[model samples]
Target chain A: MEVQLQSWQNMKLAQVPHMLAGHAMPWVLAARRSAFERFAAHCFPTRREEEWKYTDVSIIGRRSSLAPDHIPPDPSSEAKLLAWTLASESLYLMVFVNGHYAPGLSMTDDLPAGVRMASLANILENGADLPESYFDPQHEHTIFAALNNAFATDGMVLDLSPGTVLKAPIYLLYIASGHGVAIYPRNIVVAGEDAQATVIEHYMGTLDAHNFTNAVTQISLSAHAEIEHCKLLQEGPAATHVAGIHAEQASDSHFISHSFALGGRLARNDITAQLLGKSCHCTMNGLYLLNERQHLDHHTRIDHLAPECISREYYRGILDGESHGVFNGKVVVHPGANKTDAHQANHNLLLSRQAEVDTKPQLEIFADDVKCTHGATVGQLDDDSLFYLRSRGIDAELARSVLIYGFTNDIIGRVNMPELRTRIEHLVLERLPQGDQIKELL
Target chain B: MLTIKNLHVSIDDNGNGKEILRGINLNVKAGEVHAIMGPNASGKSTLAQVLAGREGYQVTAGSVRYLGQDLLAMTPEQRACEGIFLAFQYPVEIPGVSNALFLKTALNAMRKQHGLPELDAMDFLSLVRERMKRVGMDEALLSRAVNEGFSGGEKKRNEILQLTVLEPRLAILDETDSGLDIDALKLVADGVNDMRSPERSIVLVTHYQRLLDYIVPDVVHVLSQGCIVKSGDANLARELERHGYSRVETENTAKQVA
Candidate 1:
């Protein structure tokens, strides 16, 4: 396996020099080189590893060449894609087309004081704080993260200074246009003490694009800062997406993450948060809707490294038409992290006999005095509920659809932003089997 | 308006078929209220379930006709749209579907089947409000999920509210008064009484005669061991209340043996 991975790395090495040639900074070059070494050292995970037991990424590793460097931009396609994003006037939009920043489509006119936002490539070229300060190549040993760092062309970077509170959210939209392309996007977000902000990352692609998106996002929250982060993946049906989010929370800081995965042939999300300060809190909520041979996996881990911290996680999935879903949530309470409170739950509903789901929630506690609980449930729509609807004159198919929508809405209802929640509700309903029929009822 | 002939019903429990109803026969005309009184496992509830087209119950030999059409041929939803309503003994709790949305969906389905226009939101709200008043139901229940976390009496009232809103041609109440207090029983009975009309027929299946004191039945039948042992006027219910079902079962058995 290691030999195969090394050979795979060698095949893609030809593109690195071209990528490196564009950057002159020594730290940037060294970071890329170190990331490449790490990628070459590790093999793509197999089912034998417990973390990868239910997912296989060999198809991703088998690709010999890097994605094509250029794809002509289409304005009509960009407009159509932008129509799905939030239309609020206060939003700051940054667009990325084919892994490169599209300055023509971005808008950042009314940003508040002490808030700085720009593309990573632009920031790095300008000699600002090195990207190494935000992301440590040595800390991320996963093959996909390493590959993303080594080959990423551009990404978004947002920073809020001390005591700064943004009145609007930052929207980062990533769009892929061509087939058989590999696009890596790296994002860095830092919040200073007592600051507050929200960030939304949306990924989309063309229907004909069979591309792979390897993305990584790192967030650092200082004391008393609060941040709400949301990621929406509505890629093309043939696309493959692998995303990772690593967050660090300081004392009394709060971080919440909402992940909605609706499209992709094979989509996987790995989220890890470290509560490194006392009295900090973190919340992770996710919803995945899959149909027609699509597969989605969500793996989350939260470590309570200090005392009096809280972590809560709730995830739900609706699978239909031979699709599959996997959810694995792990929480660890380190020694001396007393008074920690953690709760995690995952519920899934299968709409077809062929649809499947596997969910596992784990808790590891080294602290003696802590409160932690985890649970997972996978089931079909309730027979009694279906019959009740039918007996009230609803058709069988519409009844099933309504029940499914209701099941997913339980999680969507938790989203505090009404406009965004409504948009997500529409997206979820439009993807259901009998979406047309259920749309009328809602 | 309704007819049943030689109805035999069985259920498949883990591939083992068990007969629950044996050769049951009955008839009813329009504008008539009939009461079926029986002890446990007497097939009273099974008869109601069969009429409503619930799955997993096989009719080995039976014919149920309603309004000159074959009732057994339609699906449950089809039967519901065609004006056959069954108030379930144990109302199902749907956790996320609001009661108001459920009723509108149901009412619209029935209207579409009957070639009537669907109600708009305002019209639906007014219609449900009127029916809710008749059933003595709180208006807040309309916003909550269907029977989710509802008290026993509230669930029963919700069923009555649905019956009122649907306004079916044939109504069957299966043990609707089993878990209600006296006041709730009277409220439920009054709701049923309000729907009584020349074009509608009702069959009340219950174990107690107390409910009969509020909504008097036109006819009474004593069901024992999956068959009706006796059929009489409303006075027969009073007699059953005075003497236990054991006396009636013994008399019927003696007559059969003799």
Candidate 2:
């Protein structure tokens, strides 16, 4: 084991001390050292692994040189962020530029009492005390998450006290700029009993910038707490994004996750939910609109470890051009977890002949009294639907656009926030050929 | 306003064409309501689909003319743009698209086709609100997906709603009374009767003469074995209803010579 990864391991280990954030705090430094060691020990997950069977992460492994920028927001990138932040005034915005928290651009007006929001990097630099067990040593299930944990410079550490609920959503915006730049943004949320809120994690890069964004968000909901976690990846066209979302729901808590992957040359997301207590409900819904040569893969797992837990996973992909999409969702009902209900579905619509999708829905049920159902489909637009639209004076192209938009509405409609829903609707429409005309119809 | 001369349509299966509509001839003038009554598999619905230019139907022979133009040469949307409407027997349920948006898009598309300015959302909604109320289509359904989870009667009412909103010149009602109840049937029949005008021609295709009892047709044509075997005044529909198609079985395949 010493010689197996001595040189490569040392090379990656060198990035620990040089990481842009979390250096001043010894606990953070220790956490980073262990995470980097673990990441290097495993190298990068390959096709041999069951989870990474379809995706090839060799490109990321080669480009994983940690050169995160510690610079402030540029005028142009700030302008673009300002436009978005202004558009969603109802959301508390946390802005991060080049993996470091941007205090100038971050907005937290009207923050309620008992709600704690702070920059993890600042907390570590100031030598603040973190919540107990905040840094889970074994939570990094994949190399990407480990890498993020090790190389992450700055992140949002949100603490919602028990019985405290925010009426507005909390938006975390991470912007990366620079050629071949790699930025890791990690987020942690701790909600006490009966606490509820919606959090939007959006990762974007400057136009035409080549970058890699590896992000991880760990959320724990207390009893009766509800949290809607939305992850939107809109990086540059030449960018690569890898994200891991790990959530733990207590008894009677509700957790909803929506992953909208529109930009980036290659984007992969691993979303895992642990329903640890009884009567917890988790919903995982995602929509990916891919075009050109983009590639996206989503791997989701829902573990029902307690009795009477319900989990629903629905993911849809619309692929055009020569793009490829993949979705593998797994639902596991643990032993003796009776009365567990799990449903999983993944559907892909290929607009062009060359577009392709690989979809698989897995249900591993060890409990006899549990109910589990899974379905997957990869196909083109329904001819009947197209013809129906055309019969109403809508041309073939416009009809196709409307039907495609309609297919994605199932996921978008699940979002209760009007602003987020409209933004998602716009992105899905923007990928279609007749999007402009369809917009007028609405 | 519409004429079919020696029309034939077939569905291709394994490189073989099985004809559904044999050689047929018919003429429909403006402001006239013609009832095309036939038994199941009598090519009634196929004729309507072919008229609307739905794909999978290879027009093996014949020509259809509307307003002196080649009707068979247009596409489904083009046919709709040119003032032809076919209230589908089974309206397709399009999830995620609201009924109001569908109607607005269709109405604006037709208006744009006829060189008329498009209506804005407010004007369009106002126009739709009144017509939808007239057809008894609940205002709440306008926001719901098109025909998604709608009851049978509600679906029929939606069809009448579209018919009234579009206001086409040549309207073909294909089994519109199939799944509706007596009250719904009367409501739909009244909707159709209200739309009858001197500038428009209507075709009511039904398996029973029950629909004609509400909206009396000027002419009744009995289709058998893919051909109009019999044609007469409105009295013909009642005679065929009383005798049943078995009596008309003797008239099977007797092609009508126009």
Candidate 3:
């Protein structure tokens, strides 16, 4: 065990120089070096850690490597990948293949004014100051985040000017195309004062490969700005995904995050939002559907750093076969941050006895006058509800699917985008055990 | 259209089988409405549940025949598709499933079973709109989740709407008047009365005679200890209302002893 752990540390250290070999920018190289040092200083998390008690990352370390390699794109596979796009004329699509921007596949025509969108590599090569200021290497507390910062090849950089509102949504598509390769994707979004936009990050794997995706996203909202961000992970069955989202909201700003994880062998998502100004509001909603030995873990934290800030979070999970799910949510109200109102809830449904779930919802309040509430529940479908559906001429299997859909509808209903909601509803139903029967009902 | 002969039902209680319905016998012909009135805990609801093919009940003896088919052998959904409808005493709330979708699926299932074509969207809408007037249901209710956050009266009325759409050969109403007010009760009774036809049979199970006042039954059966003690006409319902259930219980006990 000791030798294996030592070799794991050495393996990560050896990849640092390879990560910064071709980078010419001093600041970018320094950032990578700092992130690699931090990653080397801390060992990979285990079940002993409180935050990782239910999830173990050793399998990821043993199976995935850091060295980057290119895979020739298959035209048929690329076409198959494009079929999953939102197929709407109003959508502004940005495509990334193997963590590098694919200009030929992107659609940037007719973009609204005051919107600056470019690849992260392009901005870095141009000596842009925005990427340097936004990327934080010292804040890497997790091994995956550290790895993402040190080795991220390319991602999307979106900037919205003050008072700018984009009528159409922006879609960022990340496709993993090769086997046994590790890809780091870094995305940054900055919305100026009174600006509003909706952005969706869709990660998919084109081949049935044993791959790993380590993603990091940073979002900053200026005063009175509002943004709706969505993250969807539907990788190949043999893929492992780990993602982190960090958001900061200014006074009177609103931020809503929606995450749906439906595929991958093992997946973990961590999100944190800091309400730094008065009257800022933040909402987080997530859903995970797993089956056949799949595992998913979600961790969310909301900090009320100023007075009159509000936070609401609700996450749900459905596990079938031998799958497992984990949920951990926390809401914190710092001192002097009075008038903070926060609500958090986590619900899980297990379709089989072999399926399991662990949930923890917590509220830490230091302010004297604050309203914070959190709850967690894990159970199966209501037998009465199932019988009710069966009594109305639906078969037992179809009835079970209907009840499961009903369980997830609570979270899906929170989606404000009708087309996206409908698409998600269809995807969720298609993943159900008896999905065919439920399709007619939907 | 329906026959029940010496039906006995029992349920598992702490690993011991406890009999809820000792023996029940009933027969109804086409175009007839039968009222089975009994006091509480006299197996009134059990009989309705047994006929509807609900689980958790073991039929120790007897049989039920509907249209010359073995009713007890079929599943709940199968029985439903074969024209058996039960208006629950306490309707279960199913969230996220719209009422219109529920009815449409059920109606299509029944129609397919009877070798008939399914109703399309336009035809289904018109049919439901015409039936909505019978129970005075709001058009918006059709789009809402089935019985979710619905008032007691509204839930009962929704059941009536389902019955009207399915057009079942045998309809069983189990204490449908329990939670309804006078006006709502009148509306429900009118809905039941509107469904009466030469090819349909109705069964009304109630504790009070008020529901019978609006939709009078051709035959009234007094059930005591899960056995029908007396059978009479519509006047018997009024007489029972005047005399109360205690008098009938005493007479039933006396007759059993003799």
Task: Identify the candidate with maximal TM-score.
Answer: 3
What DockQ does every candidate get?
0.66, 0.75, 0.66
- Candidate 2 lDDT, A232-329, residue by residue in tens: 88888999898889999999999999999999999899999999999999999999999899999998999999999999998999999999899989
TM-score computed on alpha carbons, candidate 2 = 0.95
Against the true structure, whose DockQ is highest? 2
Off by over 4 Å in 3: A1-22, A70-72, A75-88, A433-437
Ordered from best to worst lDDT, the candidate numbers read 2, 1, 3
Summarize candidate 3's per-residue lDDT along A1-442 as a digit string, tens digits: 3455567566665455454423677777877777767666665677998999998777786763555544435423654447345444578888877777777777777888999888887777677765465547544536778877777777888899999998888888887776777778888889999999898898888557677888988889999999999988888888888999888999999999999999889899999999999999999999999988888999999999999998999999999989999998989899989999999999899899999999999889899789888888888888777777777787788778777888888888998889778878888888876676556645
Q: Which 10 consecutive positions of candidate 1 chain A have the poorest summed lDDT?
A: A67-76
Q: State the lDDT at A295 in candidate 2.
A: 90
Question: Best to worst by TM-score, what's the order?
Answer: 3, 2, 1
Q: What are the lDDT figures for the candidates, one per model?
A: 0.86, 0.86, 0.84
> Between candidates 1 and 3, which one is better according to lDDT?
1
Residue A319, model 2: lDDT of 92
What pairs collide in candidate 2?
none
Clashing pairs in 1: none
Tens digit per residue, CA lDDT, model 1, A1-442: 6666567556677357345422577777777777767776765778888988888877776665454355435534654447344433568888887777887777777788999998887887777775466446644736788777777778888889999998677888888877678888888899999999888898988888778899999999999999889999999998888999989999999999999999888889999899999999999999999999998999999999999999999999988899989999999999999999999999998878999999999999999789999999999998878887888888898788788877887788877677678778888888866676555655
TM-score of each: 0.95, 0.95, 0.96
